[model samples]
Target: DAMVIQNPRYQVTQFGKPVTLSCSQTLNHNVMYWYQQKSSQAPKLLFHYYDKDFNNEADTPDNFQSRRPNTSFCFLDIRSPGLGDAAMYLCATSRDNGNTEAFFGQGTRLTVV
Candidate 1:
């Protein structure tokens, strides 16, 4: 079945170091989003690309950034992952707005050392 995929199910990085988490999908969806979730907290929308239109959440940290070079691929880059940056990074995709449902990847668990 078509779905989202996140690489390196877990990532370990030192404080103030850069890291990149990847996400891709076979769903052929028009929108892809990156979310940061800590423990049992609600997933926080970082940013998303809707057919190349990048929409960033107002509360997303400056240390976080995203890129989508094409339809089925997207990436999350952390300029400097802090101790608090340690969290589960999820990638999700949706067909369109309104009546669409999002599918999530297994997620990359980031651990700041």
Candidate 2:
């Protein structure tokens, strides 16, 4: 019962190239989040989209973008990815904005060369 699914466990992209990672959830959670985790570092919140509302973290760069077409699907787009962008992109879903438990996908590892 995989509630959250992220496609293509691994990916590689050239510098300045664009790449898209996808996630889908079956739990129908109200909040969907995207996070970037570098090696041995904490996962940094990139953005979260819920109920048609999108929230981006202040420190997130312009190169990162996210789209939540519906409750079940979300996509993370990296435009002109730099070497610094290489990391694991994690997709998570929570029942609501409150202190509900969150379910995370296995994550898509992106390599920017």
Candidate 3:
């Protein structure tokens, strides 16, 4: 069974338009992470919520924002998506902050037009 679920597997948004990608998990994991991956590149950690505590990566752009209202849900909001912002957004969940096996969603492929 899929523990982590990301909705709208493929999304197309116009340039400068805002879009939000959602993820929900059944595992009740404490850590939920959002990553951005470009073609042939490694996934970059955008941010994560560790049980209500939000942690953002230093290099993450201001255009990206995230919300974790509760344990099961998390959302990534792109304020003004540019062409370069198009990527595959992956949602992951882990039991803890320490080294642990993480469950990943199928991911949402975003296209900025």
Candidate 4:
């Protein structure tokens, strides 16, 4: 079974519409992260949850947010999708900080119309 998985590898939406992308891991890892990566750009950390500790990147936009109800699942919520929000949304998991390597899911490619 896949350790991490994202459904609907591609998603399309109209401008100003709300959308939710989900992530799940079977590794029992405590750290889960959501990153948005644009063309050729580094994956920018939107937010993460280390157990129940939520960490959001300073530059992340207000339109983006995340949720972690338990150790195995997390979700990214976009209140109002914009064209600029169209990018690859990656979900990752790690055991901890520098000691472990993070694993990523294929990602959901959001296309805002």
Q: Give lDDT for model 3.
A: 0.97
Task: Arrange candidates, best lDDT first.
Answer: 3, 2, 4, 1
What tens digits encode model 3's per-residue C-alpha lDDT throughout 40-72? 999999999999999999999999999999999
Worst 10 residues of 4 by lDDT: 1-10
Model 1 pairs whose backbones collide: none
- Regions of model 2 farther than 4 Å from truth: none
Global lDDT of each candidate: 0.93, 0.95, 0.97, 0.94
**Each model's TM-score?**
0.96, 0.98, 0.99, 0.96
Q: Write the per-residue lDDT of candidate 1 for residues 1-113, one digit (tens) a residue.
A: 63899998999999998999999999899999999999989999999888999999998989999989999889999999899999999999999865899999999999999
Instruction: Output the TM-score of candidate 3.
Output: 0.99
Better of 2 and 3 by lDDT: 3
Higher-scoring candidate on TM-score, 1 or 3: 3
**Candidate 4, residues 1-113: lDDT per residue as tens digits?**
78999877999999999999999999999899999999999999899899999999999999998999999999999999998999999999999966999999999999999
Clashes of each: 0, 0, 0, 0
Query: How far out, in Å, is residue 44 in model 2?
Result: 0.4
lDDT, candidate 2, 8-63, per-residue tens: 89999999989999999999899999999999999999999876899999999999
